[model samples]
Target: MLLAHPALLADRVREYETLSALDADEGGAAARRRMDDIAYSLCVATGTADVDAAVVAARHRLPGARVHDDSLITAMHRLRR
Candidate 1:
């Protein structure tokens, strides 16, 4: 499987989070569409079906990610060693 570059994943994650935090009255349809797009992108990048899982996966793949962190990806990486 081809993994997404950490920098790109980080940017997507930040964009998703920022859009998610917007007020319902803010940004209108454009923001919603962008959020959906980001969610889909993140899912594809992480090879996961769920956005929450995708976010975790992206974070785990980021540079300086703690090997000892308790995330599922961290455990998986450990098992692969």
Candidate 2:
């Protein structure tokens, strides 16, 4: 969804990635807080919600992002389950 809407997501991705990098350096309490704020704002603007309370509520039920994706080698394997 984000890549599909670069005009709306580019800044967001950049912001999040920057925050993540900062956090990785061992001290980013404030930056991490700001990242959460930025994320909430971006999510709201994307027609998902426009209120902090709403954003928090929505995020509470949100699923975890996939850290990695696996490629399937065969349709048969995919449907084996």
Candidate 3:
């Protein structure tokens, strides 16, 4: 769903590859955090409530995928650039 969602701005394939690498390394907190940030960005871009709902639904489907709440986009957006 996230990949299919039109608001996703990052490269899905590259993100997935990075995530896979992080998982293999087993101690990639920074990489994992980036993945969370990307997920949150996609969710926020889709809709504010989407992240939570999608994570729940995705967990049910994949069962092993790690999803986290990285809801920083709103705050990031609010920052005066």
**Tens digits of per-residue lDDT for model 3, 1-81:** 233332233354345456756673365677767777766654554444654554444333342344554457656878856
* lDDT ranking, best first: 1, 2, 3
- Each prediction's RMSD over C-alphas, in Å, is 7.5, 8.4, 14.5
lDDT of 2 by residue, 8-52 (tens): 455565666677667733566776578777767666655555434
lDDT winner among the candidates? 1
What TM-score would you give candidate 2 relative to the actual structure?
0.38
Relative to the true structure, candidate 1 reaches a TM of 0.76
Q: Residue by residue across 1-81, what tens digits does model 1's lDDT show? A: 999999999999998887777752267887777888999999999999999999989998999897576788878999999
Q: What lDDT is reached at residue 5 by model 2?
A: 41
Candidate 3: list runs displaced more than 4 Å. Answer: 1-26, 48-81
Query: Pick by TM-score: which candidate is best?
Result: 1
Error of 1 at 22 (Å): 1.3
